[model samples]
Target: MVLSSHARVITPVFSAVGGSGRSTVAGLLATGLAAMVPSVVLDLAPRLASPWPEWSSAPGAGLASIPPHMPLSRRQVHAAAGTNPAPAGAGWQVLTDHREWSAPPLAPVDAPAAWHQLAAVGGWQGVVADTAYPMAHDIVAARTAGRTGWTAAWCALPCSVPVVCTAATASGMQALQTALTAAAAEGLPVQRMVLALVSTGDGRLPAPVRAGETMLRPRVAAVVHVPYDPQIRAFGLRDATRLGARSLQASDLLVQAVLASAHASWGDPLPAAATPAALPPAHPSALPVPEKVSIP
Candidate 1:
């Protein structure tokens, strides 16, 4: 389904580790979304290339160049093409910095203004920003998933979703918990978090996360299991048509989870009636904190 006329969704793929497959998850979600809604995938990571050909940067055009309040109609895009054909065929556009930059790239903190401008563009219904590791400093990626402060708290844009990717390992979960703890300390507004467990075999989630049992801060919404697929590792791209049967199935489930989180963040009624007792406490005071705790 398409987003509401005025709705602007910014789904950031977050992870504690470098190879948690956040980009792959972001690409698959973008591709699936493109099938239903006109979308754009903004690769904020300072990488040289992307696996999907759909992931491209417009020549000499970046987020900073878009003027405020300007209409971004197809005609306007064509006029700015400058010998390059308008980016068509894909349901989304991948916005990136020009290959050669005189200065350092912009950080995610410098994005709220640009995001406001980009959302005003015509026809685009949603945006998926494939971010780098939350702890990365030299990149222009969203550090805290689901936190508006990561982008300076947009004025017009209210609905933002974070899909947190973590591998099935002790360190992965610990890293995620640490990130959540930091977000809480900063008073970041994180309504919900989509925890995507990427691992081998069936990719079952840990008991603590599945039961919503945590001393963490951000609210966990869903636990998605994306089984490790060699095909995806080899290609490093997201295309359901090109993936194996198992990978395709997992990818579909991940897409559904991402959209569901987005809808919930947008204030839509949840599909399933959730009992408060079934979920972790949403209030900070309810969280368990050790008495005179010490970290060794």
Candidate 2:
């Protein structure tokens, strides 16, 4: 399989409806990518809804400190990112909030290219975003007066490889279908999207999930499952580095799937490189992109 250039930064998105384990998928993908190169996760979840600060090992300026509509330098980005404790965050970082309770949720991506602006910082090779949704709104929210300015209200840039997250349940599958339909309408390349099915329990895939995967198999680039790990449920991402072996394997596949996507997006030759954990082969599915959304 072709590898990444390891030269460019790509943000794989987990921008699905609430309760879809977006952060879970984003965190795993970031950690997996970090195993190869410097990587970070941009936590775009609103404060009350975010679980990041509780999971962080140290403290620093939380998301509320991000300079709105301003381009960030590598130092500025890292300063806001703070240090990630797991893996000693040797090669991984999270740009999220860590302030005390009662503070405000940081503003959304208010810049026209706010997400891209933050991602443009050069130190990392990949950025995984846990973005807010009802994307139709998020897409046009930039057009708002900023409550009164020419500036764009911050928002998530289009994902290089958008992974639609959902639980493996009948209801979850239904929401997944709705999200895909909505994403497609927003010009997102749903055909090239990846689906991360987070299992609700241990052992075999529930019949509903199996059926959902079968139905979506033909429309998306690939479908991967993230088995539920009690460790994470009990302790949050603070224990993510110690995920179960199968769960880790799923994360590896996730990383490969996105890498394969980046290679296709660039249509450039990518060579192989050693990785921390063995990864499964990249499916490398390149589907027809729609007319509206542009993924680069």
Candidate 3:
């Protein structure tokens, strides 16, 4: 069978508490993966009051705007996924910021209908649901429901689906564990859980985090560590479109590792070239370094 035939969708539910870098990571992951196979990166972040027409720093021009209760269609979601430059008159591009909305409940029923719409896209090989810390509970619940729905829709192979959680700091990891524990207590499938350690320029995990993992690691599937790069900070800008090629390359490496472990295809070629200009010099103190941690 072709790789797409055996394609397994991966849903990455990111923690908002990590800062703007999480969204950048999610976007880079999704866009990069989509270049190889059909994928979607759902920005569950909140919309700002006044959106930037494009990525700019003009004064008084506020953040982007999002609808309060709009049921998104598949096409709308796809449009959001694709590159759309900001109109000169519009001011700021519609950036994906999930924190703009008031925190919603963790129940599946409370989730935006847009999720279901995106799930229906063609090929729909993977989805990355990037969320903020305040909305982590709700995002996890919604992702669980999505996985369950996919299993139900495609009964032939159930274990093929997976959910990855990305956290900015060790505290964010704790919040994820609490949310997952609650999900397990509620009878949700916890076996598919993967803890993605998102180091936000902090190369090492906090001592308290290491201690908590000693107790929680056994319950998770795998722990993947991704270091933060200074280039990721540019995502906070108003007109941020393209990400650093090195960052994209790093994400591709993660995708390959995930696919290999899942027995998915690793030979698939990397996506097209869309490298941005050279990044501004980062402070010497900001570069990231890799760390080793025991996976339970």
**Best model number under TM-score:** 2
Predicted structure 2: lDDT: 0.65
Once fitted onto the true fold, the runs of candidate 1 whose alpha carbons sit more than 4 angstroms away are 1-6, 47-91, 97-109, 133-156, 200-218, 238-240, 269-296
Query: What is the number of backbone collisions in each predicted candidate, taken in the order shown?
Result: 0, 9, 23
Candidate closest to the true structure, highest lDDT: 2
> Between prediction 2 and prediction 3, which has the larger TM-score?
2
- State which candidate, 2 or 3, has the greater lDDT: 2
Which parts of model 2 have CA positions greater than 4 angstroms off? 1-6, 69-72, 85-90, 110-112, 134-159, 270-296
lDDT per residue for candidate 2 within 136-229, as digits (tens), equals 3443453342442211122123336677788788788887877676556555566667789988788787777788789888888888888888
Question: What lDDT would each prediction earn against the true structure?
Answer: 0.54, 0.65, 0.45
**Could you tell me which 10 consecutive residues in candidate 1 have the lowest summed lDDT?**
78-87
Deviating ranges (above 4 Å) for candidate 3: 1-12, 16-21, 49-81, 84-114, 132-170, 213-215, 236-246, 257-296
Model 1 error, position 225 (Å): 1.7
Which model, 1 or 3, shows the larger TM-score? 1
Tell me the deviation in Å of residue 37 in model 2: 1.3
lDDT of 1 by residue, 1-296 (tens): 34555455666677766667777777666666666556666666663443333334234355445434433444343232211112134435555554343556544434654543443343355567676446322122344354444422431244566677766666677766666556545544444666676774455666765444354424766666667777667755533445566665665566566667668665553232211122233544445787996889
